[model samples]
Target: MTSGKIGNQASLQSIFDPIIAAPSDRPFVVAQLGQSLDGRIATASGDSRGINGAAALDHLHRLRSNVDAIVVGIGTIIADDPQLTVRRVDGPQPIRVIIDPKGRLPATARCLATGDSKCLVVTSKAEAVPKGAEGLVIKASAPRIEPGDIVEALFKRGLKKILVEGGGTTISHFINAGMIDRIHILVAPLILGSGIPGLSLIPVGSIDEAIWPKTSAHVLDGGDVLFDCDLRHQRRG
Candidate 1:
């Protein structure tokens, strides 16, 4: 649930109700990103602390609560070392998913180490799965696992709905592959003149060729804006 007067509890929850109700037999993918006015997700040093305020973070937690699993890429693991758990809010811990097709994440990494929650490491490292994680080794190249294959695997694992919380490259992968069902982009107040961008995998010849999702936006607590974009058309196209 991103965008528009999220202050109302009922209204905020309503935003994600449709997404949460997506057909359960298949994988419903929702991608979330918090970026700057200039479109950078993080600075050159990879610091993304508090880009969006507490309210936005709470929203993220709620989204996580609604999903059956959370997916991310190795870049996110390396840069943020995110726990990928619900801490600020009260909810069940959704399964944590990491897309490290090469098995790049170290065994000591937070997402793989503590085992506070179940984690699925989607990799091409077919030989071994780390101690605290399960492996879904796609027969694809390292760092380029097919999103469709990953979705199918997750569905087989009983995870019908997936929330992809990502670093730029990972988001771009799903976007370029046209596997995303919806998008929730949080735009913060600051700007980074040069750094990592939000989505970058698609190439367009003109503004008319740009991929546009049906969207809406609303303000958050700390001068940030949430953009709730429906992208089912992409999935069909």
Candidate 2:
């Protein structure tokens, strides 16, 4: 039973799909989500109760199986407190990553717990590094490690691909910093009316845009939409 918990038809294909289906040379995938037309990621109390569906959830774990790591910002860690493990399918376990600017993860956090996969905590502040997390820490000297620096560090560690899944701020930081190689935006059927926009900041533009990544969007089952795009040089018109 995949995370989607669907019938055997969809389940069968998902179960047998190759774990390493992604191209070896491709950079990591950064997936971001906003909400449906209503503009909400959760209900009034801030719970992601209906943020994802069965099929989408299953596909999410399947996608997780293809990457080398999964990332999120500290805000997500505090909010959802996810385990960040791939459980629905069988595959090589990917590393869990957290971008904690201030090293805010609690020692009691599930991410620091054993049973789940180990986590890589990236931060620039010295005090943020946890006591038992020396090996897991990737310290950057910059006041704030830019996206390029983060990717370069990951690459040096032999990680050719990674996946970033989180709230709007983290997504925007990567996009604006121009480190995201590819983006997958899953749009649910409902909306939040007033919550965080999918992106914290949208790049201002025309031919003079600082960054441009070629992007394409697609509609999926159950009113969900997916946008997969490559981020690279864009020649001005």
Candidate 3:
């Protein structure tokens, strides 16, 4: 077995190479989710703390440090209230973004607090921007904002490397919309039996209809398995 110390650094660099080398013409979007062995992100009550081990958590912070911006839905803000800062390791913090189409984000959300990183809220044209944060309004008749529009707007703003750090629904939308280039799934060695699932894409009639991205797995410290899935070529047409 490979030592976590030696393997972790090499694996992280390898995982980030594609993202760091992406072209500047468009946004290179990656989504990440931490789930149980049974694919549950949280319990039914939504308590999702400490699912993956310290090494996986450090890897997440590393990802945040390397990316230009980190995006999440309002649901994650409400449920987790994450700071979205790079604290586990010594590196620059990334810009924090939120997808709150209906203007549901609270004024005092932790992510909105001032820090080294700026915060951007993606909302519908009619929604009011939350105080203390910049806004990127997209035209949408429905309450939901399109994932593609969000990506395009960010790219236009010079945030070409984007990380969709999520609460499942947000990640699902980007993945289903074919806007994601890669996905990193960290699965812990425990099973919740029943809880919030990690991904919820559209239904498929047969096994052949399921997605099959080019994937590689690495074992993190504390027995968590990280699946690095390259979805750039496998996205739906």
Candidate 4:
């Protein structure tokens, strides 16, 4: 491998060491988001493509390869339609888990198609999995499923390392629920003056009340900055 590739691998290892060393009885959940310098994940019309550079994209695929499963909210499915595979690197593909509370996943969604990796749909008890999707269905309480419950269910199924690859809503749910152990926020150089914001959480009254996670910053090959925030102890009680 080239020196640059070696450097990237070393950086990834350092970033993932804590997650890989997490306790086995529960899931080690990490959430990731790629946004612009101004914190917009997409434009006003929901058009989010190429927000991060090639190096940051590789970093994401490396994350997918390490985790046992990857989870996303249905909004992501409808918008990005990502296959959620480990194509950029050589590692076992993680299971694709979708939080589809309303059963809105279309029949033709790429994630639902037959593939090397298995797909699991987590829905509300009131909803059913879309027809003809060859995967397991997990049901939780109505309106929405608790992030903790989702983590527990996945852990029971042997998915101990989980990555929440999302639209902002899904990551926020996990963070607000105190189920996330860490979060990786990759910030690109561009600025979107107006668009969909990257993350949304309960507001704090003052700057002192804001969460200041123990974070480490790394510059990716193409100038995107990756902030590895350690939230293991900063989670809400």
Candidate 5:
């Protein structure tokens, strides 16, 4: 069996040693994703069909089992219409959160009416608040529905840990905002040479470059890989 160390073999320190903050009032945020060998999370046209194997999907559900909440963007909700619940195992489903900046989430989405899970739609103060949804819709005032703002709102609601399963923009927004505490990236063995790149809008510049996304990775079953990185403060690149 191939065995690896978290720090020595994979630079887990470089990835997770920094501290954005210890467990605080705000929920800790983690960005979780799986990409192809070529680092693509979807197709060239933004399709994520069959990108992950059944084992990878099941592994993701396992990861989901440990969090207090799960977040995604409205675009992801519309495109995937995911139930965003814990299944395939006997574990409590985390709360479901959607960042709908323009208040665009449909009232008819399953998230709105699910009794098994609570749904929180993060929207801007200026945008019309979504109404008639069975789920608890908590509104927070912000100039814009930014990545940091979303976490603050969740924290206020007493969720201490959040998992982000994204559509790229949402993940990148948190990465850029320096709000992500850890990143759990799963890598599949296949390669999608030309697809929607897994990362979106990382800042470019000496100052922006100072924040680096360093990670230590391990290979999981079925040729899948896992990288856990701490983003709060790693040595500025």
Candidate 6:
């Protein structure tokens, strides 16, 4: 892991010692996002092309270069049509995993187009898998697939290091379920005024009931702030 500096002299490793020290039994899930100062991930139109500064973008690419697999929700696939491969960084690209509960991702999606890495489509339905992808049918207990189920499926497939890039809902589910082992969030200076939230979940009655993770803050290349939070899955009682 590269040393991303904190406020003064704290190293990224120092801030993430707990997370780095975690057992390697299963994939170490990391949730990453680039949000606005107002905590909005995208504008009202769902545009999230260039919110992150160059440095943060590079950081994101480096992150992508390291993980064994990358995961995103079906909404992100439909909205961004991302080719979730590592660019602007030197390393092997991670496998792309898409959670499309209904198996609705279009075959023409960019992620399904071209990349050296493999793409795994996770859906609850056993119907047709999108072209250029492998299918893993995980039955849903609710209207949607559960976070724990996704993790289990990936882990059993030997995906030991995972990164989850987002479009809010998927990240919220993982966060609320305490399934996130660590997170890398870049808070930009721009404000969206009105847009989709970075983390949208059920309301919490009190701050005391919140799950507090050990964190380290740092300013990126263009004055954008990066917050690295490591969760032990322990919530305050």
Best by TM-score: 3
Model 4: residue 147 alpha-carbon error in angstroms: 0.9
Worst 10 residues of 6 by lDDT: 1-10
TM-score computed on alpha carbons, candidate 6: 0.90
Per-residue lDDT over 36-64 for candidate 4, one digit per residue giving the tens place of the 0 to 100 score: 99999999999999999888888899999
Off by over 4 Å in 5: 1-26, 113-115, 125-144, 205-214
As a whole number from 0 to 100, the lDDT of residue 130 in candidate 5 is 58
Highest lDDT scorer: 3
lDDT of 1 by residue, 130-210 (tens): 778888878885448888888888889898888999987887888888888888899999878877788887687777777
65-116: candidate 6 lDDT, tens digit per residue? 7677899999998998888888877778988999988778998999988789
State how far residue 124 of model 1 sits from its true place (Å): 1.4
What's the lDDT for candidate 4?
0.84
lDDT of 6: 0.81
TM-score of 3: 0.93
Mark the regions of model 3 whose C-alpha exceeds 4 Å error after superposition.
Answer: 1-6, 125-127, 235-237
> Which stretches of model 4 miss by more than 4 angstroms?
1-7, 125-127, 131-141, 235-237
Q: Write the per-residue lDDT of candidate 3 for residues 174-195, one digit (tens) a residue.
A: 9889999999899899999999
Q: Rank the candidates by lDDT, best first.
A: 3, 4, 1, 6, 5, 2
Q: For candidate 2, list the clashing residue pairs, or say none.
A: 36-190, 38-191, 38-192, 38-193, 39-191, 39-192, 40-191, 40-192
Per-residue lDDT of 85-199 in model 5, one digit per residue for the tens?
7776556788888877676787677766653877777765434445533233345465446676678767877877788899777898887787788887778888877978888
RMSD of 5: 5.2
Candidate 5 residue pairs that clash: 15-230
Give the Å shift of residue 110 in candidate 4: 0.7
